[model samples]
Target: MKLLTNRTRKMDVILIIVGAFIMAVGINLVYEPMDLVTGGFSGLAIIIKYFTKGFIHGGIPIWVSNILLNVPLFLAAFLLKGKKFVGKTLFATAVLSVALYIVPSFDIVYHDLLLASVFGGVIGGIGLGMVFITMASTGGTDMLGMIIHEFIPHYTIAQVIFVIDGAIVLLGAATFGLNKALYSVIAVYITAKVMDGMLEGLKFAKLTYIISDQYEEIAKEIMDKLDRGATGLHATGMYSNDEKKMIFCVVSKKEIIELKNIVGGIDPKAFIIVSDVREVLGEGFIEYKQ
Candidate 1:
């Protein structure tokens, strides 16, 4: 058991390293060439790179700026989140910093700003998502987000991150032109969405609630045909004072049509409500693991 746990930890470390490297490559190759500012320390580093273009040869290297900017943020994380959180975060940050220095900046000369923004966001988002899955971050705005969340518990980490990134992008507009800043916003949006998809798992499912006269038949068919379990709850119709059974079931996105067909065949006027389920864990779904 101990060996297995150690193996899992090792795997997580490897994943974080790979993810951080990908993120660094995206920044150096795509964001740098296009002069696009994203969010977090990376975006700030770009902004710094632009303002101080003639400071030392071709401005201060992004890796240096990234490390300098992250120092205070890392300290904040250690104070607010604890050593355990900071340990992995620091490792990921170091990986990203080294990668930004070592990775060669590719010259991707292109006229389409939209394409650059999209590719940059996608590549960076995937890297960020992988790092996040291991419960670690590439530091920068991630750490700041955690600190902000500590003080403001009501706000989600993503919301706080957006606010921080948005402010940085605005600063970017001052230096990198308003048009590029606008495109940068698109990059940020795509990055956020992709990261969300990765963190939540792409295998999205649907949670359905059905209220109908033939509830038992529909439930039985769903169980027998779809091989899914349904739970029944007694419901009262306020308008007619009619007692009814509310059938609740979760089905894969692809199975939505089939489930709808079964319900319609049983009762054409069945009241059905379907909503997206991001992640589900149970006997038939993902195992609930600590």
Candidate 2:
């Protein structure tokens, strides 16, 4: 087994704490002020708070409700996911719950549902993305998703999560009304998009395949000028039955123009195919982790 270095472990803890705090800010500051309900345990807490406001004095604060709801789920996660997984999840959930209590809530940009939804989504997405980067979850529907995945291995975790969170959003609609429910959907969508962006990285790359006669010159230029590597593959022209070389390379999106110019300078008739690459992990990109 590989052991984690001290710094890596410390960074994991920091990420969990900061992520939870950001999520709390999004919920309390943005969603709560506008009474906008999104999915997951947090949304359920908001619903509980709204209903209990009449009978329960100051009402059930989100932190209390969040803890109350997570208790049993945490127990289940420990039993199912084992100690290591449950430990990180517990850390994140605890931080989030406590943050809900400590973080002061006030409307910074009020009376605008659109702005609230957009900002809340962006903030929450960043928080969730950070937690995910540590390979830990904030333990709400995340736990539920794992549990559901165990039972029905055929259905993807994401599919199960969507169904469960969708149900909660629908319940919010019944409790809050249709308009708020629709707004909640918008928030969820924005949150998902932003989260995906964070996870996949905002800076994209391009993978290009060049079929040209001047493959050696082009490859040399790419390696020398762009500081990028290129691979030459042996190929045959289907029409002419002549041997040829295909150069394959990956470069940043901005570098695509430069790459095209280099290829054009070498061989104007070069057949080049450029495709968007979501991620590239190697010498010039993200380091591959075991």
Please, what is the whole-model Cα lDDT of each candidate in the order they appear? 0.86, 0.85
- Candidate 2: where are CA atoms >4 Å away? 1-4, 146-160, 202-204, 279-283
lDDT for model 2, please. 0.85
Model 1 lDDT vs. the true structure? 0.86
Best by lDDT: 1
Query: For residues 1-290, could you state the per-residue lDDT of candidate 2 as single tens digits?
Result: 23556678899999899999999999989888788888889999889999998999867998988878888888888888789888899889889999999998788666688888788878988888788677677888867877778899987554566678788899999998988888887788777667667766654799999999899999999999999999999999999999999999999988999999999999999999999998788788776766
**Location of the lowest summed lDDT over 10 successive residues in candidate 1:** 104-113
RMSD of each: 3.1, 2.9
lDDT, residue 182, model 2: 84
Task: For model 1, state the Cα shift of residue 224 in Å.
Answer: 4.5
Question: Candidate 1: which pairs clash?
Answer: none
TM-score of each: 0.82, 0.86
